[model samples]
Target: MSTVIAFIVIFGALVFFHELGHLIFAKRAGILCREFAIGFGPKIFSYKKDETVYTIRLLPIGGFVRMAGEDPEMVELKPGYRVGLLFDENDKVNKIILNHKDKYPDALIIEVEAADIEHRLFIKGYVDGDEEVLKNFSISPKAVMVENGVETQLAPYDRQFASKTVGQRTLAIFAGPMMNFLLAIVVFIIIALFQGMPSNAPILGQLTPDGAALEAGLKEGDVVYTIEGAEISSWADIVEIIQKNPGKDIEFLVDRGGNTLEIPVTPEVQEIEGRKIGLIGVYSPVEKSPLKAFVYGFKETYMWTKEIIAAVGKLITGQFTIDALAGPVGIYESTSIVAESGFWYLMRWAAVLSINLGIMNLLPIPALDGGRLMFFALEAVRGKPVDRNKEGLVHFIGFALLMLLMLVVTWNDIQRFFL
Candidate 1:
């Protein structure tokens, strides 16, 4: 379905850039990342590169960059940690296992009889546990083949998230959200350059038949100057005025066919979801310019970010409700609608959604980038890191609450949109 494709592309772009940001910064900070994943659930594809496994999963709702020491449950393997090596060939027996006997005295070396030098290699961590792995490596079998609550190997002390200074860890945590902003900026800039900046003058172009504009004696060639005494400079100005006043009468000063005339028009009030909004049938013309495009792109991104932050503030202060929020369902449905509006509109919506993702990740709740930064702030004040277990527990609780909230929001979206 077109909806499926649009949702995947939109969510994929935003999340990929976000995770990539963390991956780059983590590597730069000398932290070892085990996995760079683009989705959740069962992995559809995976491969090892350098020291990390890159994975693509079936779900598109989320993704993650798994850095060493970030998770408290993962423990670094000590030098004394032992493993069992099983191989089918005898020529490379000690060369692969007993050669390291000087380092690991208690390691088990099992020689299985098989034809040729094509040996099945396995380094079993906690052979007392079940997860026996068989691999076909030419030499080393030190891969983390563990099972039964095995203590896995984490990054070196210098490479762990906690081992690093507060500043380093803070940067890594904040990098994810910052990347989202960067993506929005890029998307906006490209769209502006390709499609051009929106017209500065408030000129009406498309007029819907039997709509509010037609009922008010307005024609397609009219250029609006002022609406309800507010100076209308562009299309944004028109929507801003209408949104603030639903079912309200407005005086429009327009230049129609070279004659200035005042036309009275009232916006039609409509109930969207749970909110009352106003709408008038009209469209604006887009103008192309290289210089103005860049400026407009930056300005638009800033404006969208500011508006999202304000909306979040309002939500926190009880000025807004959860009904006003769009969860996965609403987003998927909107993705379908936006996809139908052509490539430019789709890109524009992607930019807006990317900005929203960036803002949401900056919220100071547990299990989020902002939450980790909160811990960093406490460390700055205390001159040392907080108790690792306590911090982890707080994030666990926060994650649970967030999941519950998502369930509720998703249910609401389904009921509102699909049902």
Candidate 2:
């Protein structure tokens, strides 16, 4: 149960931050965002703020930000059609009721002669079915239209994704992945601040309760100079010596505050990944430095990012198998193990996953942010945008293929873990 909660919280945080990046930049570019959602299925909760509907959906796997002009509008006004309009104090049309007109008895009934909701923001029609005299009314930029009891705000031509500069659009798309990386760095910083950074020196920091080290009267801050007469220079050397001599007694020469002492200790034998190893259960010493903590945050993030990119490069170059990929089930299993370790370990796992998510989204595959950026790049070069129909078709196919790949990966994970 703890594992499930940890997985949900970690996954939800990751998705939320990524989508938030899109929402922030989209609004900065004056684009109309219809919904900011953290899942894909039926809505569990929803609230509207600043003309954006924030929703939490049933599925916890993925999320999206729906921006105006990214897709076709669900409702449209046609010429020569009859509709009813409600006006605000400024006499601008605030609501255009397509049906259920009785709900707003004060709404002016008109037969539409022509309407330009996007740019000109005017609705020209004959009042109350009078066709002889056509009247034109201005529409407020924030006006909404109701169709079948659903209210949808009208997005002006200047307030759309495509209407913005190519640079602005590119930033809006790239910000999602960028925000993921930033989230990882912040998590690492928090971990470092709360728990000091680990060191690699041949020194002990904390000892496990009832472990061999504590049982042997070994105290924290003991610098192990030698184990069984073999010199221990670094923590790696100590690990190698102890792990090799499982269930065997070893002599440790330690310097504890300038006092050299000889201690006999036996490492407990443990089986890990089918290999027998020894453990005295001592943690490496760490230093608590605020400046170093901030530095470690970026350093650790960069290191992990570099390693992940190299692994992805191998996968792209056919050096790695497709089965190496992990899906939700595999992540859950890993999360359970990490959760058992402790809270800090779980946090580190979340940071690693965030970095991975950031890198994967930056891959130039269609239907992803990288794919949209590719189109924007072409537009910059060609002096015109790609045809919307063609681009939409490409994205549709790419999304379908991605879903199929996810299913395959998830099935593989289930078989590997459960069966």
- Top model by TM-score, which number? 2
Q: Model 2, 72: alpha-carbon shift in Å? A: 1.5
Pairing residues by index, what is the TM-score of model 2? 0.91
Ten-residue segment with the worst summed lDDT in candidate 1?
Answer: 115-124
Indicate the residue-level lDDT of 232 in model 1. Answer: 86
Q: How many backbone clashes does candidate 2 have?
A: 0
Kindly report which residue pairs in candidate 2 clash with one another: none
State the lDDT of candidate 1 residue by residue for 277-358, as single tens digits: 7777776666767777777777888999999999999999999999888888989888888888889899989999988988
lDDT of each: 0.75, 0.93
RMSD to truth, every model: 8.9, 2.7
The estimated TM-scores of all candidates read 0.70, 0.91
lDDT of 2 by residue, 318-365 (tens): 999879999999999999999999999999999999999999998888
Q: What TM-score does candidate 1 reach? A: 0.70
Identify the runs in model 1 with alpha carbons over 4 angstroms from their true place: 72-154, 202-282
Best by lDDT: 2
